[model samples]
Target: MSDCNKTDFTNPSTFILLGIPGLEAAHVWISIPFCTMYAIAVLGNFTILFIVKMELSLHGPMYYFLCMLAVTDLVLSTSTVPKTLSIFWFNSREIDFSACLTQMYFIHCFLVMESGIFVAMALDRYVAICHPLRHSTILTNSVVAKIGLAVVLRGIMLVLPYPFLARQWPYYRTYIIPHTYCEHIAVVKLACADTRVSSYYGLFMVFCVRGLDMIFIAVSYIQILRAIFSLPTKDARLKTLGTCSSHLCAILAFYIPVIFSSLTHRFGHNVPLHFHVLIANVYLLVPPMLHPIIYGVRTKQIRDRLLRLFTHKGM
Candidate 1:
């Protein structure tokens, strides 16, 4: 109701984000874990990026997707970790309206880009497995570059409406985002004007992008399975499947929680905020944190290269 007043809303130039409730009582205790996760997320993704770039053997389409994913993970985590950590350490949760919108834009942009990358990775796998004879022709260097550009453009286009819709709300006073990050829906909730159109559009976009990505991934894997089944030798099948294992695991880890959170947010609003926050954070942070480890362990060459790099640096 306080946000409904035009004068009061316009007068307040900044708004505070009330980060995860109950943290105020145990800030010091929470800081240790939060800081540790933040460090791991950043360092882990950076290490993956470094390893991918340093190892010349990983210069193929597979590792290309991995590198792009690592970059996306870095950008994704960096978009929110700083503010989340600051809330715990400095107890400062206030954010300017403009800054809030900026953060929301970048966060959503990277997220959609990540989704696009996943789709592209699926296509890469499809080519490698289902149509090996033409894999090189289908997923060439120039094609990968074009795919990367398309992903960025798609992400920007999809998320552009969020900020535009947000700016049109002339009566948004309190900017107390319930969650730790500048999620689009969370920011839209602060709008004094009716957000039905924006919310519907956002939900539609979420489903379309994520849905299409998932469907394509599924179709790719199905074809891959068919192709593997037709192979005469067990060794060939195993080798082909082995190449896809890490990607399958990464895709499952990333999409499961995201789909779960999206469903809960849309249909399970009756669920407690604690449950929502837990699911949302896991969806955002856990996949990125786990992705590098998954790939490193599954790919022997990358693992060995990373070990040698760490050994040389005495880390």
Candidate 2:
């Protein structure tokens, strides 16, 4: 009981991660699925990268954006999953402070990058379908390169403050984090000092960066929908919408779990701790695993290439 009440005046050099507060007994069993998802996410994203790189026909803005998304998913998931699995499977819960901050930075950085990639993809589809005549001219290779660069810079600039701000706060409360990964809020809340500024900054980064990205995507899609509807024939509209199906699936796969997890963490006070941890894990793991599969299945070009590759291998 005394240990529970004790506080450390110095910032911890190492923080202990309690994988899931109430689910310790099930950690081993839980690790099976998490491990499986990580493996699949890695394999699937690499396959997407492979397909896009090898297919000359895919040398366009859309596939370039897909490659960006795949790479972001890889980094985002890799930032947390291995450590999480270690906590679950081997009971290796202590993470070095610097390592934790690095993990936090990579996870949020790639998350923002992924959102920007989705917006780029939406714009790609909008131009292709809405203004086919100018699609080539507008989304040229150089323009796509510029957009990618901007996305990378935006992510870096926005998330760079997280670790610095976290470092400044005095973590006298406890060195134990009740989650698998070093989330910004999870780490900051351990500080005994006032954390409202850090907390509000997190909210600001989310709403300002991701919120604006979402708004851009939404507007692009509205314009896309108008263009699709204006098509004279049902088949024409269907064909055009088909091109966006994979992107739409990817967007939902990315945003729903993320938004739910963020809201649950900040606002769902009645929610169980284990449930919150599970949702946080799901938001990171599920999207990466699902994204490549969604694109592979919905995209006819990629689907055909995958089928050919496997069939040739079988032969």
Candidate 3:
């Protein structure tokens, strides 16, 4: 282990992904449910964007941000599930080194991009409720476009370093990533070289991306709360609170699972490998699956349009 050569630092040309840990025998069955979830996630998010685009009345600040969220969900789900299903059904586990890197980059990139969109949505609600008269000028479509551009650029810049930093590190040991997905930190753990730099950068990226977004979102809601309370009647407060339910559902669904998954990844050494794998997979899958459903059910605009599109029914 002490002996180090130049080759020790060379990137492994390929890697094997170990699908679900103890459930190897049941991987085929497991993939059935996994595929169903992925189908719903992809189709659900696409539906959100499709309805938003089709219905002119749905064209507004909130729905525009919803479109961005749907796009991120689509990217996030596709990046992992297709390869994951292949590994389960076809026994295709070997992934090219570059492809693995690309997957890791997109996973983190879209994950953070999703978080950024949530923050943007929170800000949208804050402006809508807190400063109602100024909401139009404040959250104009042009401004939303600028925010979307910033979010995309931010995610790209933050996640870009993961691959570049890992590419230079030599892998003297095994190239088998234990997790089903090639997450940034999980893959970084495979490098034989000193990975402190990349590890810390990954942590920083986590804080900059997820942590900062969560902070801003919390702050936005706090201001929004005060504004809602200032309303003259309880009905007004309740109605305002109701408007935020979808965003709140999304934040809780994503952040709670993510927090547990991160903790298990960093600290849960005694935890079963499958347990860790399950939480991580769910962390990614649940939001995309639920976000569109929550919005469709909770937002009258989307639900009405979807119902009309489906049944050609009612005024």
Off by over 4 Å in 2: 1-10
* Residue range 119-238, candidate 2, lDDT tens digits: 999999999998899999999999999999999999999899999888876675468999999988889878776789888988887788788989999999999999899999999999
- The lDDT leader among the candidates is 2
The local distance difference test score of each candidate is 0.82, 0.91, 0.87
Where is model 3 more than 4 Å wrong at Cα? 2-9, 313-315
TM-score of each: 0.93, 0.96, 0.96
Tens-place lDDT per residue, model 1, 43-118, is 8788877887887888888788888898888888788878877887787888887888888898888888998999
Give, for candidate 3, the lowest lDDT window spanning 10 residues.
1-10
Taking the tens digit of each residue's C-alpha lDDT, what string does model 3 give over 35-139? 999999998998999998889988999999999999998888889999999999999999999999999889888887888889999999999999899999999
Whichever of 1 and 3 has more TM-score, that candidate is 3
Q: Clash pairs of candidate 1?
A: none
Candidate 2 at residue 179, lDDT? 97
RMSD (CA, Å), each prediction = 2.2, 2.2, 1.8
**Model 2 lDDT at residue 30:** 93
Scored by Cα lDDT, where does model 1 land? 0.82
